[model samples]
Target: MTAETQLPQATGSCCSPGGACHDGADATTGGVTAVYRVTGMTCGHCEGAVAEELSGIEGVSSVKAVASTGQVTVVSEAPLPEEAVRAAVDEAGYAFAGRA
Candidate 1:
């Protein structure tokens, strides 16, 4: 599939007041939202690993990973410490490219 096709759309409606997704219910606090560039991810396995790792992070409520671009977008109910996110990526054997 094409790169565009490979990317998973953000789950639920994000910006609409009447959207299914609840606002701030699953979002990060401190006005901090991040899209991290995760390296060493080549396939579903990598994606799964990254997703799983991020899921365990405290305050991290949602994570969407795109393997083709090694990108992971995370949303949390509270501001997630960057160190925590970085550790997740590193522990998963992937390189963290900081916020993008």
Candidate 2:
């Protein structure tokens, strides 16, 4: 099988990973989606690390990171309190460069 066929697809609700509900709309209570651009991301590993960091937040529903552009889109069950997101980025050794 090709690499594409070998990878397992992720299954998640609107609140789960890789779900399609990240347009500033709340996934849990149907609130709003929050998109942020992170800085200091340069590769797939950086994206993975950032995604992992965001995923650890309590209210974060999912994290999509595009390493090429250093962009990170996050969906939240509720409003993503800035401090929380910032903390995650900081812990991951990156800088949260506001929303893009």
Candidate 3:
């Protein structure tokens, strides 16, 4: 018998690493979606780091970071304060370029 190679299945969510996923709707609580520009992200690792830091904020439902475009899409229960977002991005060792 010949051996066959198998690969992991895709979840089909836009949350994949280093890619842009705009679900258009919040994943939880029907929250609002906000997009912000960021700097210094050059790879999936950068995206993950930014996402992680932003995800830690209160009221955040979901986050998607795209390194190529230097933009992050965030879903939250309401509009988040600019300073809060900036601080989170800074915590991840990147610069927040404001809303996109």
Candidate 4:
């Protein structure tokens, strides 16, 4: 791998051509959203599991988990602390590969 190799910045979409994923955050509240690269989410149950765990965290307003894309968008009042997100993903029986 070259040192110049750079990962795409995390957005609502997972690196689409036009950068559109439609991961909606409540604009009225100006909620903060973070896209995480979650592993081992291959089914709806897996998505639900991850969402369920993440939703328990304080200040988390919503969670949209897409299994096929391996992207989990978490919407909260503010950018969530990494430790909180990491623990939630771990508790859900998945690997937390950090933000996208």
- Highest lDDT model number: 3
For all predictions, the C-alpha RMSD in Å is: 6.4, 6.5, 9.7, 10.4
Model 3, 1-100: lDDT tens digits are: 1111112223333453433335544433356668899999998888888988998889886787888888898877777999999999999999999999
TM-score, candidate 4, is 0.72
Winner on lDDT (1 vs 3): 3
Tens digit of per-residue lDDT, candidate 1, span 2-99: 12112222444455442323433422132234578988888887887888898788766557788888788776656678899999989989999887
TM-score of each candidate?
0.68, 0.70, 0.72, 0.72
**lDDT of each structure?**
0.67, 0.69, 0.75, 0.73
For residues 1-100, what per-residue lDDT tens digits would candidate 2 score against the true structure? 0000011233445655634464655444354456678888887778888888888887665677886777787766677789998999899899999988
Name the lDDT of candidate 4.
0.73
- Model 3 RMSD, rounded to 1 decimal: 9.7
Off by over 4 Å in 2: 1-23, 26-31
Cα displacement (angstroms), candidate 3, residue 83, comes to: 0.4
lDDT of 3: 0.75
